[model samples]
Structure formats: C-alpha cells, structure tokens
Target: MPAVVVVGGQWGDEGKGRIVDLLARKARVVARYSAGNNAGHTIVNELGEFKLHLVPAGIFYPEKTCVIGNGVAIDPEVLLGEISQLASREIDTSKLAVSERAQVVMPWHRLIDRLDEERRGANAIGTTGKGIGPCFTDKVARRGIRIVDLMEPEDLLARMRSVVDYQNAVITGVYGEKPIDFDACFAQYQEYGQRLRPFVQDTQALITEALRSGEHVLLEGAQGSLLDLDHGTYEYVTSSVPSSTAGGATLGVGIGPTDVQRAIGVFKSYCTRVGNGPLPTELFGEIGDRLRDHGKEFGRGEYGTTTGRPRRIGW
Candidate 1:
C-alpha cells in the first residue's frame, strides 16, 4: 500500500517517462505495468537521450530495481537490443528484472500484426507493427507464451510451436502471407532465452518484497488512460489499460488497486495523440505547425518515438 503510479494524463506523450525518471529517485523499485514496444518513453538525461520502449525509464538510477511487469508484452529482440545499447553507454542494467508471467511477442505476432494492418487498408489502426495487440490477444485467448516458457527448452519449443502453427495458418490462409518458419523462429528464441534468463524472475514477489519492507515503489503506466481498451474510444484504444485510474497498473504488475497510495498524472501544455483515434480537439495548419516546431516534432525529433509519425496536436 505504498506504491505511487505515474500515468499519462492525456493521449500519451505526456512526459510520463521524465516524471517517472525523476520520481524514481525516491523509489526503491520502479515497475512498468502495461503496453509494449508500441508505447515509447523518450528520456533526455545527463548521460544522453534514450528512447525506451520496454525497459523501465527507472533503469537510469542504479540504486532502483526496475521491473517489466506481468501486464507488459515483451518483444525480446527490442528489449535485448535496448539493454545492449544501455550497457554500451556504461549504464548499469543488472538491476532490471523481467516478469516470468509477462506475455512474449513472438515472430508470428509481429508478422500477423503487419499483415492484418495491411488488410485493414483504409481502416488501419495506425499500429506501430510492433505486435502489441496480437501478443495481448494471445494472452487473453490463453495461447500466450510467457517468460517462464522460455526458461525450459521443451516447454519453450512446444508452446512456441503450438502458437506458431495456429498463427502461421492465419498468416498464410487469411493474410495470404508467408508463414513463419517454426524452426527458424524457435532457434532465434532459443538464443534469446539464453540471453534473457538472467533477468527473468517472479517480479510479483519482488515487488511485494519491496512493498512489505517499506520501500517506496513507483508504478509506471504506458500509453494513456483515454486509450484504455474498455474505457477509451472503441476500436481506437490500446489493447490494454495503461492507467492507474482504471487500476491497470495494479493488474499489470500483479498487485491490488488499493496498494497504490498516490497517482500522478503527467500532462503537456497541449494535447497530442499518435495513433488513429477520434481527436475532436485536434489542431492542424499553422497552430499545429508552431506547436510541432516548439515541441521539436520536426527534423530528427521526438514526435512519435514508436511510429516516428507527426503527432496530432491540439488544445
């Protein structure tokens, strides 16, 4: 009951990452609760500017324990690459932990994501093609491969093959795309398992231990409250709730809603949304241009870290 949640007050890109990075100084544990690589957190610190997708922004603080919680769908390649990048900069990432219960974003998931989005055509959801939705779909459908599945060779192979077979059928039959090669996918993940095993653990227990010991915990939310699957714009929202207002952080991290003692909503001077959605207050033309210019959305800028598309800014 001593957790603090930092959530996006708008349609994401509300500077939640910077807030979490600053607040993490007072927290012993910082945990990401929802979304995946589809969501982005661009943190500019003394070391450098790091655009975080999966790893918690709290990783900057060597003293804090950062966790990829159960609510997160992990893309191993992205996460591993991010870790390598950080390590290259002399950043200490040994304190990070990946939840055993977190969903895995497999190769098929990424493939199907792009294929399906292309099929949508005019109705495309403007996805980052990072497979966040598909990975969560498998999680809800009970066909997900968890982090623990990667630990044991037999379990990993069996689970990966089962899901791959079904997904491969959809990929070829429905999307008319090439099916994911099971052997190749399996081999790649086998290497990923070896590299990721050290960070995999019972993150729920770790968080509980930190809480029970009276250590301050920070729960970081991704996307935004208005993009919540159940609460936001239908068909336009994210696949999961990434806000503490809807108890997403608790559910994502395997904790109770009551455990969060405070929730800080981060907001910008203006509203901005990245993906497809009905943004009524959305601005365009000169005002929008100036907003983008001031926010540095132009050039090699920080408009949409996940999609690299210009954000729809408004009042």
Candidate 2:
C-alpha cells in the first residue's frame, strides 16, 4: 500500500490536524515522525474538539494504530496524560506505541529550556517552556536519555544525576539561578518511566512489518515545512524536517523523489507564526486583535504541541 505524508506548508498551525483526522479513515497506521509535544494538531469533529500533542492525530480512529517514531522527543508524563484524556472520551489507545529509540524528555531539560528562554529576554523565541528544544539539544550532543535507558532504573537514576549535576552547575553558577533538586527531578522521571514502560516499542520493526503487510500509512508532522530546520527560514526554524523528505528519512521508508506520486500541502487562509522569526505578513494592533476576537485565535490557551508556546494569530 502507498504511504501518504501530510505536513504544514508554512509555519505551525495550518489545519494539518483536520486533514490527518480525515485521512485516518483510510490509513491502517498514522505515525508521528518527528518533533515533540511542542507542536499540536487540533481536530474538531462530531465526536468533539481535541488537541493532540504527543500521540498521532489518528488516535481518534478506532481501527487505526498510532505510532510515535524514533525521530520524536517524548515526555512520558505528557504522553500518559494524553492517553488518559483520550480514554476519558472512551477512545481506545491500546494500539498506540512509543519507539524504544525515541529520546525521553526529563526534568532538567524543562528547567534549562525555560532558563534559556528567559536569558533571551526581549529577544525571546516564545517557546512553550516544554523542554523540547533542550531535549533535541541533548540528542545532538549525544547525552540524551532514550526510552530504552529508562528500562534500567539504576542507569536512569545515574544518568539523571550526572546530567542534573552538570546542568545545576551551569544554571546556578552561570545563569545565576537556584539549583534544581536532583532527587525531586529523578523521582519525577522515575514515575514517568514506570507509567510509560508499557507503551515503549521497537518502532522500526513494527513499521517494517506493517509496510511488508501492505498496510497504508500516514506520516504526520507537527509543524510546517517553512519551519523545517534545514530548509526553513534560517535560525527561526523548528528543529526537524516537517516535509515529505523528513517522513521518508526518519521512518525508514527510503522513499525517493520519483516515488512521491502525489503530494498536497495545507495552509490556513490567515497567517500565524510563533517564537522568533520573520513573519513578513503578520497582522497586529487592532487589526490583529479583531482576528483574534472574530476568528477566536488568541492566547496561550492554543499552544503549539511541540514548541509549547501560545500561537501568534494573524489574518
């Protein structure tokens, strides 16, 4: 079966969530390939309104399985919370799986993340204070903790302690902030690890098997293409590839240029951007306020799933 990748054509929040929910009916599996809880897809249907962060948007479909791919950065606590919310709605999340290879977002990451944003001061990128950027940083720096690492409580504790000590030194000494309690942070993640253990999976194996069986898949991105780190608008971009290229690379599909028979990009009629970037067409003042009021696009109430900041609304 063919694989379809849906992504935002501009910055974050371009109605990609609605499309994902619509396509979920035909896909056997809907996979989230990258980013973290920093970006989100809000879906409104007859069932009700939903804001999906960690898990795939296809969780709404009872027949479809949602896979969180390795390229993603996860906060187990956040994922569990999302699962609980879904269950409350009588949604079956039994098919949801977390890639063992995905990196785990810990307490220290959140602390440093906020501190980093604070340091930016007036030049703030408007992060959601969710530790996503820091988690990605740890991954690139080769000092990240993966879901597999959480399997060994001893290793998990040791690693957290080591990272915490280093981070606390920088935070207190360099950033001039109070030190974070190593024990408290460690205990919190331990609980998350315990709760999320059941969902950890070998995503590569599972995805390969699904493909071999000829099941249709949908690879979804949290943000848009222009926010892609490599191809987006310079330093203002998000940390991953929010395009078809990213889908193929991270998911191990190895899909090439010609392999893409059809591709559709989604964007809203209005324009919106979050964090630091060049929003050439941003509307503010009374005009922007009008859009927020009339269109109901305002406040931190509607934050990005991966970035965690309230979306900047424009028209």
Candidate 3:
C-alpha cells in the first residue's frame, strides 16, 4: 500500500498543490478527490506556471496519470475550456480520466449561487458565487445530473427539461428572476456532453488497479482541513471535505487510521482566506495590506479558481 495522501491543515491556500506536484514525480497516479474549480493550486517551476482548478496538479508530468474522483462536482464547459488552455501550452492531458459518478454543474448552479449571495446581503458568506454550493445541494437532493447522464440524448433532455422547469419556477416565483430557457440550456449541455464523453470513466477501477500494482498513488485534496464542511468554521466552509482523513474516503482508497505512514501539512509564510468565514488569525492593519500588496493580492491575480474572487491576504 504505497499511498501518500496530501491534505490541507490550515484554512485553505495551503501549499498542497506544490506538495502534490512534487510528489507526482515518484507517484504513478495523482487524484483529486473533492472540490471543484473554487480552489486554485499554483505550481511554479522551470516548466512555466500552472494554476490547476479541476485538473490535477500532476498534469505537467506526462508520466503520471491523473484522476478526477466522483466526490467532485464538475463543470464540463469550464473543464474542457481549461483543458484546451493546457493543450495550447503543450501539456499532454490525455492521461486524465474523470469519474462517471461525478456530478455535472449546470449553468443554473451559477445563477442560484449569485442569488444566494444576494439573499445573504450583509451577512454574506463571501462566496465566489460560482454555483458550487447549489451544485452540492442538487447532488444531495438526488436531483443532480451526472457525467454518465450525458451519454443518453433523450434521457439528458428529459432530465434537463424537468430540472429547468423546476429551477425556473424557483427563479421566477421565489427569486423574482426571469425564467430559464430549456431549449437554449439543453443545446449548450448537449455540446458539453459531446465534448466530455471521452474523458468520463470508472476512475475507481483505474485507481484500484494502480494501487494493486504496488504503485505509489498520491491523493491531492483541494481546500484546507479547517474549511471542511463538518469541521470548518460554521456557515463559512466549502461544500467538500478537505482533510487527509476525508481525502482517503472521498478517493475510495480506504486508507485506514493506522496506515502507518507520514502526515505532512503545508502552509504559507503568511495567512490568507477567501470569502466570508471565521478567520481567527486575520490581520487588519497595514501589515495585512502590506502582505496583500507584496503578494500582489488583487484582481483575479491569485483569485480562487472555484470562486474567481480575489483572496484576502494576511500575515
């Protein structure tokens, strides 16, 4: 059982990406078990720069295979768009495989996400407004569309129409917004389905086979342990699990409590967090601004990949 699990110990923005990228050199596989594009992993090496959202950080090394696990809620359009960018940079993403069980993030997820923020008003959770929370909500409700659903045209359309009708009612009647157009939305999803079909797979089997071969597999977790839904700051945590313990469970690796290995946590020289959450160690003086400025923390520079919002820097 040569498995290495990399997880965040702090409130996120930890250097988990760099650690996973470093470990990817020796590992046969690198898997992202949870979280969406909200978290951004910045890997800076001689091979230019890479900020991975949905894709695993190990993509830079062609030798390592990357898996996107079922626990993740995927946005196919965003993922394909990002993959194209990687291709433009000459990165070989052919080794990437996504789980058929992964949930699809529809356009309404984004709309509902923003509406939820607006509803929060002054009590906002500082969301990226990327539809992550809403996506998770749909997933838990058992009403979400999965990657495999993309394969069947009639089924996909039927599901899409039903969901759009349901969502449009909420948008118009409850949220006082315009109704969502099923035809347009269905067409867009159809294109996404066509493009994403090739990457969808049974990642569990692929990863299990690799583990059985005595190969080293590293589980890269997005977000931080402190931001976990169950353990993180109340009402301010991400929808997914971010701890090492959860990483194993989410990845389906079954890494036990006594796996008898090393546990490493990464943190920056400073502290920073994005969105509305309880930050016990946040700095509010010139030092905070200095750290933010020195880090070039503004705009979409190092913004949350999942949220697309600029992160708050601290020291």
lDDT against the true structure, each candidate: 0.86, 0.75, 0.76
What are the C-alpha RMSDs, in order, of all predicted structures? 1.7, 3.1, 2.7
Alpha carbon RMSD to native, model 3: 2.7
| Estimated TM-score for each candidate | 0.96, 0.88, 0.91
Top-lDDT candidate index? 1
Clashing pairs in 3: 37-306, 38-306, 125-276, 126-276
For the record, the alpha-carbon RMSD of candidate 1 to the native fold, in angstroms, is: 1.7
Tens digit of per-residue lDDT, candidate 1, span 1-315: 489988887788888887888898889999999999999988888997898999998899898899999989999999999999999999999999999998989988888888888889899988889998888888888999988998888998888767777888888889888888788888888888889999999999999888889999999888887787877776888875344343788888888777889889888888888878888888889888888767763244437988888889888
- Worst-scoring 10-residue span by lDDT in model 2: 252-261
C-alpha-based local distance difference test score of model 1:
0.86
Alpha-carbon lDDT of model 2: 0.75
Model 3 TM-score, 2 decimals: 0.91
Which stretches in model 1 have alpha-carbon errors above 4 Å?
241-246, 297-302
Task: Order the candidates by TM-score, highest first.
Answer: 1, 3, 2
